[model samples]
Target: MKKKTKKSFIEYGVIIAIFSGFYFTGLHTEVLGFLQRGILATGLMDPDFDKDSGHAVNTDYPEADFSMKLIDSKGENVAMEELKGKVIFINVWATWCPPCVAEMPGINKLFQDIDKDKTAFIMLSVDQDFQKAIDFNKRKGYDFEIYKSNGGIPSMFSSQSLPTTYVINSQGELVLTHMGMGDYNTNEFKEYLKELY
Candidate 1:
């Protein structure tokens, strides 16, 4: 009788231990999967700064004043002049471009990190349908303002390619223009913005 009681106690202990191990393992796996998803979703997860390609030309950016119509997600019209006294990042992109889609989250991250009172970011969609641009902004939950450029307005800025970004200083001078997608939220880009102020 004493031997049977001891065997029964040992069997219960083993069962409890196995159950605890499985429970902890399943919990850990779930937590790790959630962390991985979070990292992949946010642009701030990585700090890799891509160097500007040699093709970037340091042309003297001309001082120009132009008016464009920006429609918010709510369909309200915002004028370009209303954004004066703020550093503006004007990105020209189309929804179909893969590089443009890839660069969007970085731009959104940069917009979120900056001082909003002093800086303004605008994405100008070259898509034919303005509603598509509005939908994209809604789906992405982007914080930056988006504008739909008129037919001749984009040509005035000398933007020849999709995913081009122009950084305008506080004084409204077009300063830096990048041809392709880049890590706009990097420390180096922030330093360049600091110089403008």
Candidate 2:
């Protein structure tokens, strides 16, 4: 009995040590994000346009704040206003965020499948060191355009979560907002976005 107990303790210690190494080396974020990708694959986290998600469909959607500023990879400035008259999909995220990393692949897939002429997809990175985001994108080989905030984020774009998403229609009204990770690359979501414009 004592030998069995000692073996169990040793096994637990090894597990703890492995986890500690992962955490200190910052590998846990990707590991956790990989685990979360499985959950995202379940399609339970996808944004629902109909349900009372943060801003309900029936309630008045405030005019989208076009004051948000962004800097593209080429160091070009962009304002929300520049994307007017088009359906917009804005995702606020960070490299250290596990859920954000998890949903990114789906977003890129959606970006590839969507009609770019009618819709604009903005991959907004909130990382303090924007270079980290740029490097991560390069490492992942995602083709979606990435941006970092150039100035203060507008009040309407603010959320209590890390991976929040906002959808604005061509009419420039805030139509939908979802807080948290989501599997956005789907026929249903694509159709819903097309319907927005």
Number of backbone-clashing residue pairs for each candidate, in the order shown = 0, 0
lDDT by residue (tens digit), candidate 2, 97-174: 999999999999999998899899888999999999998999999989899889888888888898999998877888
Error of 1 at 150 (Å): 5.1
Question: Which residue pairs clash in candidate 1?
Answer: none
Q: Which number leads on TM-score?
A: 2
Candidate 1, 122-152: lDDT as tens digits: 7888888878778777877988877775434
TM-score against truth, every candidate? 0.65, 0.92
Q: CA lDDT, every prediction?
A: 0.68, 0.88
Off by over 4 Å in 1: 1-61
Give all candidate RMSDs, comma-separated. 12.3, 3.0
